[model samples]
Target: MNHDHHMKITLEAILPSHAARPVKCASCRTMLYTTQNDSGLCETCDEKHLNTLNFWTAAQKWEELVEMNRWFIRGDTTTAPYHIGRLWEETDPLIAQLLELHEYGFITIDSQPEMEHVSLSIAKKWHLIKQRAYLTCVLPTRHSLIPISKIDGLRTNLLARKDLLVTTYCDNTTYPTPKGQGLQDAIPLTPEYKHFTDVEKRIYTFRSTADKDKDVLTKWWEAKTRLELKQGRGKFTESRTFWANNTSRITKKGSILTGPDDGDFQAAAAMRPLVFHIAAREWDAGMEVVGMLVKMCKDMGFEKTFEKFEVELED
Candidate 1:
């Protein structure tokens, strides 16, 4: 409105520093020594409370360096993800790694949205480290809902459903044993128990039979085909379902159970490990079966796929 006053303001803006030198941080009011601030934090407070770039993982940094370098090699350096300051807003490790790469001068981040979008896409496809059974709660429970530290006993002689109740302090706890059948160790299901333990979602795939028996795979294939054919464009009913983390480590983790993960058989068979459906019921038959397999492997001799086998029961 006033041309002379406006000219003075414009001259001041061009001459003065953008940030004002404050004695203390605007947020925490902590003492500021070397840092010249305009309502900003000191280095310590910045890293503790606000800095997201400070939490980079070494492995992820190396990886993003590779990825961004690939883009750099294509003669395009200024992409959205590389320039996004938003990527360092939260303590996500993947974004932290990206920030590290940017700091290293490989990436020149220009925008926020591309970095956020790209980082999120990478996060979605990221895999979790799958856990096999250790203190696995068998009692008709999903594996993810069972907290790793909450299980009571060491990994030896674990039962899922039959009266084996560990003392867990669930909210508003009440345990009632059924009449005449006598399930003193029956676990009570609670809303707190269900939701409180759902920490991380892990994924698993196929597990092999104990002896690497092709028969099991054959049966799986044949039965799956038969059942699929029998279904005939209807909803499939899987009578027997088996799941394992992988085909290896049958010796380390227990032999893969051939039945359902949640086979509430009204007995000890109701819980984790899910080994009720084994054809050979006797424990001696277990050794005999393994021995025969070992003999076969030994007869086949060295230079085979397996170096050796040891029957170990570990978590």
Candidate 2:
């Protein structure tokens, strides 16, 4: 799997706090802040490539950790490139990535392997190959997908610990994820810690910001007109409709997301309103997409379609 190349991490450096400023996006004039990558993309535009950037950023650390541990040395050892070793128990972000690589078959094993452990050199080599790949295939679009060193660094810290979800939140900014006890959280449940005594002090924070658009769209969907039901702009964000791709809008028809080919998108842009049957997910590479009842009914509104399928216990 392309063992001849080295992984290069061209991710941008972290900008100091003093250098921070809120500037307009060069392309769209949306607010661009220093908290993001030093480049020009706006927060909304930049978030689109976060998954891609995060993957490569993790790869860089994997390379560093493997190198620092002296697991494999190029041209120094007569051993073959693929070095089989017992899988590490450490859940360090880099080591976790190594485990992920083994899960995905990048790290191979012998025929009579014990518990099917990882191949160290192969995993490290994969780290190299992916970094090289990012440079060629992904780095060219750096303006759109520039790396945010601050966030990357923070995530590495959180993921290093096998279990550290969140500590605190900025007042009401975080999403109100349901408690395991009840909907009102009267008996606040904690997924992190268990109660052995009368009191088990635990905190489960919903750090992610609630999607503001959902509130607006929900209001619009509740009492939309027949015309609005046929054609209304309840949601503007394409990111909500598809997982990792907005281009799938072209393939869907008669659904809340009509075909991109049938003048549906342009009509919404020029004179018509747009309505999307929204479904959102947080996932990365190698995850599967399962649609329970994605089938569309043209007579039904987006709100009804959503209520029919792909829901959590509370949704």
Candidate 3:
């Protein structure tokens, strides 16, 4: 794809009345009217709340849990970055319930937001990445001999293959791109060139990594040599130049471009692998969020569209 797209699908959940809007102080049940006191506690109770057994017990339990998980917990007193440890064993029952929900993947609790606003917002970005990867798989990389009579037939076949691949492997229901636009936009048609008198010609191009598959180059070179021997030297050179000019190379860590010296066969071999690598890396980055979504769906006893991503797990 020419451009990198980042699409996010947010999942939200409704909170209970008590958690959504607090009418009374959490500790003493006294009517609350202002935000002056933290933890939604009345002044009298707020001072005593910190020394309670429940508070200390919750803290100790959280500390032990982090230790078992081998994760560090730092104190975020006044200007420190917000961490889950900041809510260690809170005294208020409602806050504690919210914290538990955050821990279990039911909600995403950000330290900057009010406890009530910390609703679940799972981003379906990884799922989109996998869809992009599937689209890349159908890209036309291998060159096949085409007869003049079968040019239209080949185009029809290519279209059918793309449609089938996208419909089968992609979650099209929520895919941000319009139907028939995602992969089609990436695989552009090559400029027309006259090849032999009245002969039908088309080039299927894709991006690839350099130096990974030398055998592909060898095969193409062999085919080129045979074609040149039969049809004269310059007959096949034009097509080869077209392929080389359009083909991209994965030269560095995050770079992809059409090098000036790349040959047609070398470009063809490198295109698909390079595109696959880019898509796979993007998919892997979002797998953590995807896993959380899977867990949340299981916990809620509901099947999500993403749960159908079992097809992607296969090689």
Candidate 4:
């Protein structure tokens, strides 16, 4: 994912003037002649209302104010309006309010990652106002992947996994579905979709390599265990067998599956000692499972610790 950014302004152009120049107050239709940029406020409003410092600071205070409202019922509680208004509001009243806020220096507009037409319109209005108005825009920071190294106590079993991490979009909504089912299922395998939609499932492969040690295995198990605690493990299976056609048909002596009467199933079975194994079925679940692998590796002091860990975050 990509994010667009923009700055809001109302004036067509701003020309610098000496500090002694006079300007009309954004509110009350009062002439603010003879006032410098430092004291642009009229005497009447200064005593009754907050000036630039208070107004701007109040708007800034809304920065981390993610909650819009809250409700409780049936012994459960929830909040709403994680975000207010779409990128912009379409109605004239809404536009008027936004402009009013701008005039009073209550809010600063920006365009970035996204410049919604509604938001752009607000910026245009700001531009039309004071050319030298103090303005700043902050783009939201995006995290692309979760850092699994920071988590602890991961564990996993053939059918279950844990320690998986997921990224979130919009400040306050539950991820929509389980993560990491194959393309055939409703969920997506790509991390982008995984984070955006809040899909929870095991998508990455998890298994032990010869280089891993007991401590590494322990940590991996702990992480997996945590995942199981949070999200119950969902399971699925895949089966395969290998065998040679015929020894005569097997022109190559070294070909295990190519020997005479060597059925395909037996041949495939011969390739790996562990056969008919089941593991976590979803990407999110798989991550939990892999967390165990990573933890174990770290505990054992493996040189290439955390090499197998995978996490998904919003773009």
Encode model 2's per-residue lDDT on 42-120: one tens digit a residue.
4543442332232222332222222212221221211112221222232222333332322211111111101111122
lDDT of model 2 at position 41: 49
lDDT (CA) per prediction: 0.23, 0.22, 0.24, 0.21
Ten-residue stretch with the least lDDT total in model 1: 200-209
Residue lDDT tens for model 1, 188-275: 2222123333321111111112221111110111122333434543232322212222122221222121112312212112222211
Two-way TM-score contest, 1 vs 3, winner: 3
Instruction: Please say which candidate is ahead in TM-score: 1 or 4.
Output: 4
Residue 48 local lDDT, model 2 = 27
Worst 10 residues of 2 by lDDT: 130-139
What is the TM-score of candidate 3?
Answer: 0.17
Per model, state how many residue pairs clash. Answer: 7, 2, 4, 71
Write down the TM-score for model 2. Answer: 0.17
TM-scores, one per candidate:
0.14, 0.17, 0.17, 0.16
